[model samples]
Target: MNPILDAFWYILPAYFANSSPVVLGGGTPIDMGKKWRDGRRIFGDGKTWRGFFGGLAVGTSIGVVQHLILPSYYGSLRIAVEVAFLLSLGTLIGDLIGSFIKRRLNLPRGYPAVGLDQWGFLISALCFAYPVRTIPTGEVLFLLVVTPIIHWLANVFAYKMKWKSVPW
Candidate 1:
């Protein structure tokens, strides 16, 4: 497969995981309204349990579908589940970490931090998935180049759809 296409296909779970949060997130914040010593919200109101779990479910479901439809594309069902779980979990964790940093820096929730907001989940997903599934260097590089643009566009679309308060 073409490197770009391969990377796009391989990273679908991460993509869905990163985006599902916005559509499904709400209610209690992950930090449970806690604050840091700096008097800032640990992860702000943006990070929530619903979002994290919802993203995981959606991403994993998609991966399972992909595996069932094209077994050769991403290896066995077991591997697919592993990839989905790790990528989805990693994406949310990375986003939470980003939010923590943002709060520490006194940046408000929904504020854009350039590459951090765009690439954090992808980087984290890659870190988690790499141990179980070896991704090609070329595909990794291609994803790195492509994902941010897609992230930006998705955020913009979400903003326009009123799902998000701001567009990055």
Candidate 2:
């Protein structure tokens, strides 16, 4: 593949990882109402199993597609699967960790986390997959910094559309 195409292939997962559960995942927290009890689910009403699984599926699919379409960029099929699993798992774990911290701090669900939820996915994915796969530290930092802002923007849009109860 060409240099631009190679770059696109390399960045695919980063962009994919930046995708929000609020935007792609088909559940809404506003519909659950403001009452904390009604809003309190695993990671609040907005964070559903469907969203989690959907993210996993998306991550895995992206890895698989990259392996098929740009094997030269990503190496072996096994590596692709590992990367996908780690990325998706990392994203969900990060969001969950953020929720735990929020609860400990007495922050209510749908309360803006500033950038926690946004960055959580990437951090968790990296940490979780660290043992299995090695990624460059600079690249990791780039993902950490970029993913949250991307997430925040996505949330802003989701909030405007009433797809999410809060924008953080």
Candidate 3:
């Protein structure tokens, strides 16, 4: 496969993890409707249990299907599942961490934090996947360069579709 295509495939779990939340997330907030001493919502209403788990399920399901259809592409079924779970969980965690930091900075929910919104998931996914898989330098670079663009585009699409309140 082309290196670019390979990189995209490798990062699909993270992409799905990052994007699915906007569409699938709702219900109770992850912070359990709590607030900080500063009177800010802990993670805001955006970080929800439903979103977190739903994104994980969607991303991991995609990986499982990929593994079943193209086992050679991801080495093995077990490894693929591990990588998928790690990337998906990491993406959700990263988003939550970003929201936490935003709240600490007094930014309102859905406020644009530039790189934080774009790179947080990629950074966390890389960190989580590092223990399970060795990502080539080229692929890492490709992901870094491409993720923000893809994220921005996806957010725009979601906004236009009324799935998201903001197009970050």
Best by TM-score: 1
lDDT sort, best first:
3, 1, 2
For each of the candidates, give the backbone clash count: 0, 1, 0
| Local accuracy of candidate 1 as per-residue lDDT tens digits, 50-160 | 998999999889889889988998778999999888888888888888899999999988988988888898999899888888579988888888888999999899999
Per-residue alpha-carbon lDDT of candidate 2 for residues 68-140, written as tens digits (9 for 90 to 100):
9768655799988887777677767777678767766677776877667666656677676677664566666
Candidate 3 lDDT trough over 10 residues, lowest sum: 126-135
lDDT of each: 0.88, 0.65, 0.89
Per-residue CA lDDT of model 3 for 1-168, tens digit only, reads 888888888888989988998989999999998998888888999999999999999888878988987899888888899899998998889999999999999998889999999999889988988888856899898888988899889989999999988888
Candidate 3's C-alpha runs over 4 A off are none
Off by over 4 Å in 2: 1-20, 23-42
The CA-based lDDT of model 1 is what? 0.88
Ranking the candidates on TM-score from highest down gives 1, 3, 2
Question: What's the TM-score of each model vs. the native?
Answer: 0.96, 0.72, 0.95
Overall local distance difference test of candidate 3: 0.89
